[model samples]
Target: MRCLYLWVIIALFLMTTCPSAHADEAVATQSFWAGLSTKAKFQGEVVSNLVGGLASGSVGNALFIGGFSWDSERAGEWHGGKVVINFLAVDTGNPEAYVGDIQGVSNLTTVDSLMRLYRLYYRQRWGQVTERLGLLNANDYFDNAGVACDLLNASFGIVPVLSQNLQGMPTYPFSSLGSMVALGGGDTTLQAGVFGADAVHPWQQPFSQGVLMML
Candidate 1:
């Protein structure tokens, strides 16, 4: 784990010091997509087993996400409203699939070969409250801890109670037609959302067979 942390520092150092390695690619991409309301991020990692569990091998995963946000005020559509559409492509395989581990090796390998429309939602902000509707993920809005997400364990990222009990609460790699409402001020905030739930989600079925009430 220390090695992984060291590697991260070294990689960041290289990215800052070795600008020549990626300068051309960055310039080319920027020039090609000069005037656009879109941004893309590429994130991936390969986690190799260093000790005890899950075999002495490696599993790799990558997530490439691209999104376009349209501002209602700028686009002259409506005031205080914005629409964002995102696409996520996940290429991954779990190490636990081959050799079982209690906590798994990496969070990236949790889902594999998934190409989906991750989030396509419209949010309207009015005063101190914001309302979001459309295809969305629950993890995007609820039960988030900034520091706990720093670790590599998947268990640390999500709530164990919700993950264990909720059938389909509009989370990662998949989403449902849900509405999220957030209210409050600087120090205190309250968030609540309603989503569709089923034994199997209807991302494939497309709302034909699911109940739209998950508390």
Candidate 2:
């Protein structure tokens, strides 16, 4: 466990520092605009059962996220083209076990401790119209309310109607293969996509697993 933390820190340091290692001015100017981001958060909670819930216990956990984005136009390639990659790693521990509910007290909790590719997608835009494809989190495009982000409750992040009922409503920890298109910009935009129902194994039963369509 400590080794995992060490490696993740080292990897993040290398990613941020190595990109500018090239001293050649010409090479630097020609290279695409690559942006890197990393986040490390540690959270602890105490649950007191004054009534009939779960047991009164406490748990502590950590979450690490890293991401990179490249702009093609900056590299002298075609305009309106970009690529994004994201990775997520969570320390083992279920905060919900102390709360006795599945909705979850911590948004970072997953079925199991996991470190996987969270999102890898390509986006292209032509005027007000934009398109994206590959492993995606549906929450990024739909039901995304900026005002509710600061809340810690899992249900506050997304509506239960979709998260609980929608078979494969792509949310955190389980992005699935999908494609989306959007028109318009600013205050109003029309967007839609078809995503694989089985987010855990998107490749299995690709067609029969059902699909999630949002508009």
Give the top-scoring candidate (TM-score): 2
lDDT of 2 by residue, 1-215 (tens): 99999999999998887766754554656574432333444444433345556666666656676777777876767889888888878775666666788666766666778888888899999999999998999888888877765436677777778887865667877788999999999988999898887777766675467888888
Clashes of 2: 0
List the candidates' TM-scores in order. 0.71, 0.75
User: For model 1, how does the per-residue alpha-carbon lDDT over 55-92 read when each residue is reduced to its tens digit?
Assistant: 67777788788988777666544567878899888898
Off by over 4 Å in 2: 1-29, 33-52
Residue 140 lDDT in model 2? 81
What does the lDDT read for residue 30 in candidate 1?
64
Query: What's the TM for model 2?
Result: 0.75
Q: What lDDT is reached at residue 25 by model 1?
A: 71
177: Cα error in model 1, Å? 0.9
- CA RMSD, predictions in order: 18.6, 14.0
